[model samples]
Target: MATDKHCKNELAAPSADQCMDHYGCIYENNHLITLMVDPADGSIVDANRAACSFYGYRLREFRKLLITDLNGGQEDDTGSFLDRALPGGKYRGNQVFHEHHRLASGQHIDVEIHTGAMRILGRDCVYTVIHDISERMRSEKRLRESEERYRDLVELCPEAILVYSGGTILFANQRTEKLFGIVKEELLGRSIDDFFIEKPLSSSEYNKLKAMSGIKDSFRIEQRFIRRHDRRVFDLDISGVPITYNETATLQLVCRDITQKKKETERAVRLQEQRHAVGFPLEDKAVLDKLYIPANTLSGDFFIFHRISDYEVLGIIGDVAGKGISAALSISALRVMFMDSLHSGLAPVEILQDLNRRAIEHMGEDYIAGCCFHFDFNRGMMKAAAAGINEFMYKPGGGEGMRITVKGTPLGMFAGSTFEQTAIPFQAGDRFCFYSDGMELLFSSDELCREYEYLQGKIAGSVLQDDCTWLSLLIT
Candidate 1:
């Protein structure tokens, strides 16, 4: 019966006297600051206990002050605010939020004020509900400072940095602008599709990144990125990760420019292609048949054969110590030295001695393992020298193949190193196969003595699994 009467008195009462008393009861003890003000003249007519406590002023003291007195800034803004809030004596606008207000102690604080029109005791008034937002404003300011610090930190990074959400780029660093040839403003708010040219970035791709399995949730891709203005494609090494940024899920990407490295690789491929022609000469089928494959754009294994005379042909198979373009370059220097002294009528050991001197002068300390041989058809014999190299020969005249292990210092290692020469008589039924270390892995020790077709079957494709070379000096 008491609840029914209380509800009836609070909700059903329509008289101004009862409504004013109910409103007073609600606002007087409310936690939020409340004030009744005369809108026409910006005069406070009444003040709640919360308002007095918040502003450090009693009701009589507050009634003497205007609403503009509470505003921290000049009264100009308050005038405009009141004009907007109470246009034509009606409160139709949104509450003025994030406004700076002052307390009676002169301390400034952030506030949000709700304004609404009402009539109390036959007089027009506005009830103001004030919310202090000092804590929220301080948090937002700190967050802004933290964001600025992070941005400043990545600004010095050489690689481009980007932060995105849902495939939409939200933040891009200065390097990102420099990389994409676009301004910071242009990169911001752009989609991932604008930069990547390999495949279009969509929701599915973003989801895949988010769903990537790992504690850190990261992935890397080496591909291409297109510049927006010039449409220039850059070889890019890109990595992405799912991270928490500003309490929201985000994807951060770091892109590095590898355009120069890509160009160098392409040039190496061209050099390997050109070197393939001269590296193996098929002009003399009666001499030898050759096979060569590079593990990469540059071959570490190389060979060259040239007929020194009508009866004498000199051949050398070498495996440089390392892989890639560095080894390729060293071998190229070795080739130049060998060819320069080829017709000098020097012996096989003397030729290697001279090549060694040239290699040390030009090719640094990159050691080479190679075998040099001079085949003499007229003499029916082969004079070979090994410089830290091994050569395999299947001599039917001797019943089995013997591996020729050369005992000499590698080229470019020392100045006085000598190549040990061996002279073996050439028999018609004998076959010789020279293979690099990489090629040896594909076949067993016994298989190296078998026919070359046996080894070809193990090769998956035309390309060798490693930097490899094969030279068969068949005396048919």
Candidate 2:
């Protein structure tokens, strides 16, 4: 057995003779990739079994090559690494060098080498322990790319976003600067109390905010924000959501300016209330009951009834295909067209054709789903024509109720599209229900009161996703 001083330091045996045999056994059978190189000439002095398996080189072949041969001849070769690893021939604790090494197959891998100065049989040498770090490097690269993409999205967002902790602003997006009328450098480190008129957040309130995990769990409120430069107060809808920023729990505030929206909403409410106050033209004839629920302040669904004669009435119900103020304006135009058609004494089919033409010319790209019907009390007949508003529930006097569906293209869809008309006979005590597409009903009962209660319960239990309107008529 060969005597090596490195073993005496590592095994801590009582004497050099006792550690000689154990050192050789441990070095030859160790799992870690190990190598011993002559520091003076950079020649490979010895290699363990693990190093031979990792580099695909026999011990004899490893001994013939220099350390730089396996290191791909990088500038930080054996001599420079040894200088950094063991300055002044003394081993610096935990000195590591990150480098690339080439295998026997010419493949290269990222590695971190732990090097130390050692003496084997009175000769100076450098012992290196190598570890593969390719996977960790790839993971770090992916994390960097993901963070860059997230930063881009936050900068380009339209709404103002700010990250804060304990009422102190930590981060703010570009929109935040524009909304607050302050530069980003000035906005950061400012207190939330400076901008908002709301009460300062208590310690408990902040803890509650930090406990939130998702958008649904967040807190939202409408408040007033004062601009830092002009001190002008504006309405804002804000949401506070919990997030992790730089390994710290923080609250992110998303603020939306709603000053203009509030003004528009007030005007729309006044108009809708005035429209509702107007009397229905066919009120004296047979408007038994009605319901109108708009999803927004302005409604897209509308109904109008005009009595043509003492024994006859004309009624039309429709839904516009858009939302907001634009859809409300379309309903206004449609109401005027319906009144004009009825005054001219046009039939149901002719009235629909005329409305379709007017919709294409005046409504631009907006379309409408409408149904018009004529009731003749003396003739005991009802005639209905539809475009897009196709299905209706009809219950004859002393008969079961059935759905009446007519096939027709929506108004303003095409210039030459045709419509179909349906006619059914009815005596006294017959019931009719006309509705827009937003109303979803099972029609389980023929009575109008039961159906209306079902609809009311449905609306009460769930959030409204669209506008709904229904009209019930009874023959007397």
Model 2 scores a C-alpha lDDT of: 0.77
Residue 319 lDDT, candidate 1, scale 0-100:
84
How close to the true structure is residue 291 of candidate 2, measured as C-alpha lDDT?
Answer: 70
TM-score of model number 1 = 0.60
lDDT of 2 at 67: 82
In order of appearance, the predictions have TM-scores of 0.60, 0.68
For all candidates, what are the clash counts?
A: 0, 0
- lDDT by residue for model 2 (284-359), tens: 5454666788887778888877777788878788889888777777877888877776654558888888888888
For each candidate, the alpha-carbon lDDT, in order, equals 0.74, 0.77
What's the true lDDT of residue 436 in model 1? 78
Tell me the tens digit of each residue's lDDT in model 1 across 83-117. Answer: 74586657775456446788999999988878878
307 in model 2: Cα distance from truth in Å?
Answer: 7.9
For model 1, the run of ten residues with the poorest summed lDDT? 206-215
